[model samples]
Target chain A: MPMMLDRRSVLCGGLSALSLAALNAPALAQATRLRMIWWGSQERADRTNKAIAAFKTAKPDITIAGEFAGWSDYWPRLATQVAGRNAPDIIQMDYRYIFEYARRGALAPLDDYLGKGLTIDDFGKPNIESGRIDGKLFGINLGVNSSVVLYDKAAWEKTGVTPPSMGQTWEEFAENTIAFGKKKPKPGYFATADASGLEPSFENYLRQNNKALFSADGQLGYEPADVAAWFKMWQDIRKSGGCVPADVQALDQQNIESNALTTGKAATAFAHSNQFVGYQALNKSKLSLTAYPRVGKSSPSGHYLKPSMLMSVSATSTNPKGAVDFINFLVAKPEGVDLLGVERGVPASTAMRDQLTTKLDDVSKAMVEYIAAITPEVGPLPINPPQGAGELAFVLTRVSQEVAFGRITPEEGGERMVTEAKRTLARK
Target chain B: MALHSEILSKEGRASALRSRGTFRRILERNAAGYIFLLPWLLGFFGLTLGPALASLYLSFTNYDLLQSPDWVGAANYVRILSDDPKFGAAMRVTFTYVVLSVPLKLAFALAVAMAFNRGIKGLTLYRAIFYLPSLLGSSVAIAVLWRQLFASDGLVNMALWQIFGFEGPSWISNPDYALYTLVLLSVWQFGSPMIIFLAGLRQIPTDMYEAAEMDGAGKARQFFKITLPLLTPVIFFNAVIQTIEAFKAFTPAFIISEGTGGPINSTLFYTLYLYQEAFGFFRMGYASALAWILVIIISLFTAFSFLGARYWVHYDE
Candidate 1:
C-alpha cells in the first residue's frame, strides 16, 4: 500500500511539472517587429520579400513589415510623413529627393555607421558619392544610370530607317525622323516620341553647350536664347511631322504605356538606359539603346553618370545599426545585388556587376556595356534644386503650352521662362 | 393686533415668490433647447468659421508652410491679376468649362429621367445601371481608363477604323478636343440629377395629367404645361449644385493630364493651378489668394443664379 501511494505521488508531480513548463514557454520567446517602406512594382516587391525572408532566417527574433507604392505617390507621401515627424526606419529614396530630404534633417548621416563596419568599398566611390549632400553621406546608391535613346528594332526595319549611332548629330536625327514619318504616315503614328522636359535631358543640353542650369554660384545659368532655341526645335519637329503633336506629348506623359513608341506608333523614345528593364515588360517589340544625340560642342562632359535612386536611413530610426547593415547589404552583398538586379542601375560593385551579368538577361547586360563604353569625363551629378524649383517645372509646362497653342511666340515663351526662373531662384 | 399684521405680510410675500419661480422655469426651458444645439454650434465655430477666417488672413501674407509668414499685403492678389498670365488663362478655361458643361449635363439628366418615368419594367435595374457612372465617375481609375479609351490606338480609334475607314484624333490628348471630351464625361454621369428629377416627377399630381389628357392635350404639350413647371424647383437646385461642382473640378484635370493640364494647357482648370502653387511651388500665400478669389466668384455666381430663379422657379401656393 505504501509503495503504490508513493508511485501515485510521483506521477502527479510529473504532470504538474509539465503544465508549469508549458505555461512558461511564451515568456522565454522574444517579439520584435520592424517596418520598411519602398516604391516599386510587383517584381521588385517579390525579390524584396525573398530578401526579407533571408533576413528573418538570419535573425529569427526580428519581424519586418513592408509598405510600397508607385513612384508618383511615394515621395509626396514620404514628405508628409517626414513633416509629421513619424517616418519609417529605412526608406528607398530617389536621387532627386535625396538632397532635399537630407537638407531638411530628415535623413541620418552614415559616417558613424561606416566607422563601425559598414563601408561600401565593394561599391565604387563615384556610385557612393551620388547620395552625398554638403559632404555628408545621406544615401547609398544601389546602381548607376545614364540617358539613352531606346528604339524599336522591328519598327526601324519596317520603315527602312537606321537607328542613330553613338555621337550622331541633331541634323541626322531630324533627317531620320522625317524619313521614318514619310514611310508610315498614319494618324496618331509618328516617327519620334516627345523629348524629356527638364532634369537629365535639359542638363545634358546645358553641358553640351558648356553651360549649366545653375552657375557655380548657384544662380540662373543660361541665357534666354538657349531656351528659345530648345522651344524652336520642338516646334519645328511638330511642324515638320517628324514628331507627335503637342497634344500627343501630353498624353504620353499621362500614361507611359500609351506613349506612341510603346504602342508601336513611333520609332524611338528617350529614357534612361536602366529603364530598358522596365520597358521590356511593357513592350512586346525588341528595344535597343543608343547614346543621347550630340549637340553644341559634343564633349564627353555633355553626358553624365547618375545614380537612379538611393537607400537612406531615417534620422528618427530606432534601429540605425540594422538600417546601415541593410544598406551595406544592398551595396555590398551578392545576394542583395541578385535581388535588385539592374532595377537600381548597373551594379556599383565591379565583382557584383560581373557576377550579375552571367545570370542577367539581355537588357541588363546591354545597359552595363553601354555605361562602360562611355569616357570617364562624366560631370558630377547636380544637386537638388531649391524650394521653388517645383514652380519652375510648372512654369516650363505653361510656357510650352502657350507656345503650342500659338498664344505666344517661342521667343516670348523663352522670355517668360527666364522671368519665372528668376522669380523662382529669388525665392530660393 | 401685531400677530394679524405679521401674518398678512407673510402671505403677500409668498404670492410674489410664486410668480418669480414661474418666470425662472420659463428661462430654464429656453436654456435646454440651446443646450441641444450646442454640438453643431461648436463644430461651426471650431472647424468652418476658424479656417475661413484663417484663410482670409493668410491671403495677405507670404506663407510657405515651412517658415513664419511675412505680411505682403495685396502683392499676391496683384500678381495673379496682372503679372501672372497663366492665372488669366486658367480663369478663361474654367469659365468655358463651367458654361458649357452645366447646361448640357442638366438637359441629359432631364431627358433620361423622363424616359425612366414612363412606368417602364425593370426600373430598378435601369436605375442601377445609370447610377454606376456617378459612383465611379470622379475616381482616378476612371480617369486612367478614359485615357486608355481615348488614346491614339484605343478602342474608339479601332472602331473608327473598322466602320469609317478613317482614323480618329487623340480625343483626350488633343488641345482642341480635350475640353469637349471632359464635357462629354461630365454629361455621361447625369444620374444624380436624374434621380432628383425622378423624385420631383413622382410629387406631381396625377390629377393634373388626367385633366390635361381629358382636354385633348398631347404628351409633349402636357410635359411643357404641367410637368415642366412642377419640376422647376428641383432643376434649379441641381443646376446650382452642379455649377459649384464644375467650378471646383480637380481630379479629372490631375489624372487625365498628369498634373500639367496638358496638351497645351487646354485642360488646366483653376483648382489645378492653385494646387501647383500650394504644393508644387510652395506658395501658400498665393494659393490662399487664389482660394479667396474662387470663393468670391462662386458666391457671385450663386447670387446670380438665385436672382434669376425668381423668373423660372415655381412653388405651390
Candidate 2:
C-alpha cells in the first residue's frame, strides 16, 4: 500500500510539472507579445485592426494582440483588469477617464518617451499638452473633436424648415426645430433628440453661460438655478414637440445606432462631431454636422477641441517601449494614419490630417472640415471632470427624464440634480 | 487461534504507537475520493470563499479599485443605509420585483405544469419547448431581443396597433412599464419550476385523485383539497429559489436599460445597482457593503420562509 501511494504521488507531481511546462512554453516562444485594448464600434475596430496589421508588417518581431468592447462595457472591464494587475500593454483612454487613471498611477508617464520613440513634433504643442495631468504627460492625443448637432440634411430639407446653423442662438434653434415639428413632415418624427440629459450638451451650455460642469477644485461650478433654467428650456422644447418624446429619446442609449436621427424618430441628434461618420453610415438620409447652438448671439463658443480619445501605455505593462512605439506609428506614420481615417475624430497630427484629407470619403472629410471650422470659435478646454462626474452624468439623465415625464418640476429636478451631484462628488 | 492473537496484539501496538490512527485510517480509506474532490475544493477555497472573505473585509473599507483600501469601519454600510437615495430606489425595485415576479412565476409554472400533468401526448416535446425560454431568458442576447420587442415601434406595439387600434408606450423605455416588461420576461421563463412541479405531481399517487372522484368531488375541489395541498412542499421549494433569483436579477435590466437602470431608474435591481456602484462608479467598498446587505436580506427571507413552511408546507407526517 505504501508503494502504491508513492507511485500515485510521483504520477501526480509529474503531471502537474508537465502541465506547468506546457503553459510556460508559449510565453518562452513569443519574443514580445503586447496586448492592446480599446472601446468602439466595429468601424473603429476595423480601422484599428488594419493599423495593427500595418504595424505588424513594420515590426514583425513584435506581435500584438488586440481586444475591443463597446463604450459602456469598456471602462469597467479596464478597471477590473487594472485592479487585478493584468492590464493590457496598450489602452485606449477617454478624456473623462485619463485624469482618473493617470492620477491613480495606472498609466505610465509618456514624458520620458516623447521625442525618443513618440515623435509628436507635428502633433502641435496644445494638442499634445491636452493629455497632460498634474504637469505630467500621461496619454497621447489620438484625435480631436467637440460637441455638435448631427442632423439629416435631406430630411430637414424635405420638411422645408431651415436646419440649425453653427452660430444660431439656443432660442433660435428651438424655434426653428419647433417650426419643423409644426410642419408635421412625419406622423411620429420630432425635430431633434432631447439633449437636456447629455453631459456634453449640458457642459457646452455651461461654457456658453460662463459656468462650467466642474470648478477647478472639482465641485459644482454652476448653481442649481442654472440647472433649473437648463431643464426649463428643454421642458419648453419638449412641450412644443420640438424634441422626441421622453420615452422614445430614452431608447437612444447615447450610441450611433440608437440615435434618434439614425432611428428616424428625430431629424437631428446631439453628439460629438466624430460620430458623424458612424451616424451617416447607419441612416438612409445624408447626415450633416454643426456646432451646438450658442446661449446667445454673442456668447462665447462652448465648443473646445477635446481629445476624442487617447492612447496610453499601462503602468503595469512589461514593454512600455513597445507600447509607445505602436502609439507613435498609429499617430504619426502616414501609412498607419491612412489605415485609420477620421473615425476616431480627425487626426491630431497636422501632417496626418493633411495627408488623409484628400484620401478620406465625403463623410469623413465633413468631420475634418467641421472641426477646422469650429477651431477659431472654440474656447479653452475645461478642466478635467471630477472623479464622481461620470456618475453625475447619469444623475443628470435621470433627473432630465423625471422632468420630461412630468414626475418632477424643473425646479425640483434641478435641486435634486445639484444635491445628488454634490453627494456623488463628496462620496470620497 | 495463537496467530489471530498475535495479529490483534500487533494492531494494538500500532494503534498505541499512533494516537491519530483512527483518523488516519479513515483518511486512507477515502484518499481516492478526496483526491477526486481536490479540484472542486481548490475552486471553492480559491475562487468562492477567498473572494467572499475579501469582500467582507472590503465592505468595511474605502477601497476604490485603483487605490489601496483605507480602513473606514462601517462608513460604507452607514452611507448605504442612511444617505444613498439610489440604495433606497434599488431596494424598492428589487422588493417589488421579488414580491411580484416570484409568486407570479410560480403560479404560471404550476398552471403549465398541471396542464401538462393531465397526461398529454408528446409531453417530452412540450416540456422541452416550454423550457427553452428559461434556458435562454437570463442571457444578454435574450435581453437585447426583449429590448427590441418592447421598443415603441416594435413587434408588440405593432401588434397592439393592428389588433386593437391602440398605441402602446415604449414598454422598454417608459418608466411606468419598463420594470413590468422585465417582470413579464421573468414570468415567461417559468419552465424550470414547472419541470420540478411536474416531477412533484408525478410523486403523488393517482389513487388519491380516484378516491376524491368517488367522493363526488369535482376537478377544482380535488385540485384545491389534494393536488394543491400535496404540492405545497414543492411550491415552497420553488418559492424560496425563485425569490432568491428575482432578488439577484440583473442581466435583463442591465441590457434592456443599456446598463443605466433608467427611464428614471425604474429597472434598477439591487444587483444591477451594486454592479453600477462597483464598476460604473468605482465604489468597490460601497458595493461590497451592498452585496453584504443583499446576502443578509436573502438569508432572512429564506429563514422566514422555512419558519413559515410549518404553517403551509405539508408533509406525509
Best TM-score among the predictions, by candidate number: 2
lDDT of 2 by residue, B241-283 (tens): 9999999899999999888999899999999999998998888
Clashes of each: 0, 0
Instruction: Point out where model 2 deviates above 4 Å.
Output: A1-30, B1-18, B21-23
After the best TM-score superposition of candidate 2, give how far the Cα of residue B234 lies from its true spot, in angstroms.
Answer: 0.6
Put down candidate 1 lDDT per residue, A1-428, tens digits, no spaces: 55555888999999999999998777645635556789877877887887777777766766667788876667656765764567888898877666667776778999777647476776666776777778898988767888777888777778888766687877778778778778874555777885634445666777777777777566778878888887787777767878877666666662346556776667788777777787777888788887777673356446778887788888888778777776666667787778878876887778888888899877778878888876365677665455455456656766776676567888987898888889777853
Instruction: State the C-alpha lDDT per candidate.
Output: 0.77, 0.91
lDDT of 2 by residue, A1-428 (tens): 44566888999999999999999999867768999999998888999999999999999868889999999899899999999989999999999888889988999999998789999988777798899988899999888988999888887888888898888899998898899989968788999999999989999999999999999998899888989999999999999989999999899898888988888899889999888888888888788889889889899979899899999999989999999999999899998888888888899999889989999888889899999999999988887777777788899999999999899999998899999899888877
Docking outcome class, model 1: acceptable
At residue A56, give the lDDT of candidate 2.
93
Candidate 1 lDDT by residue in tens digits, B1-317: 56545544774455456766756544453455568889988899898899788878889998764445789999999988887777887998899999999999999999998899989999999998998898898889988888888876778889999999988878898888888888878888898998998989989989999999999999999989999999999999999999999999988888888777777678889998898776655576898999999999999999999999999999888
Q: Residue B55 deviation, candidate 1, in Å? A: 6.1
The DockQ figures for the candidates are 0.31, 0.77
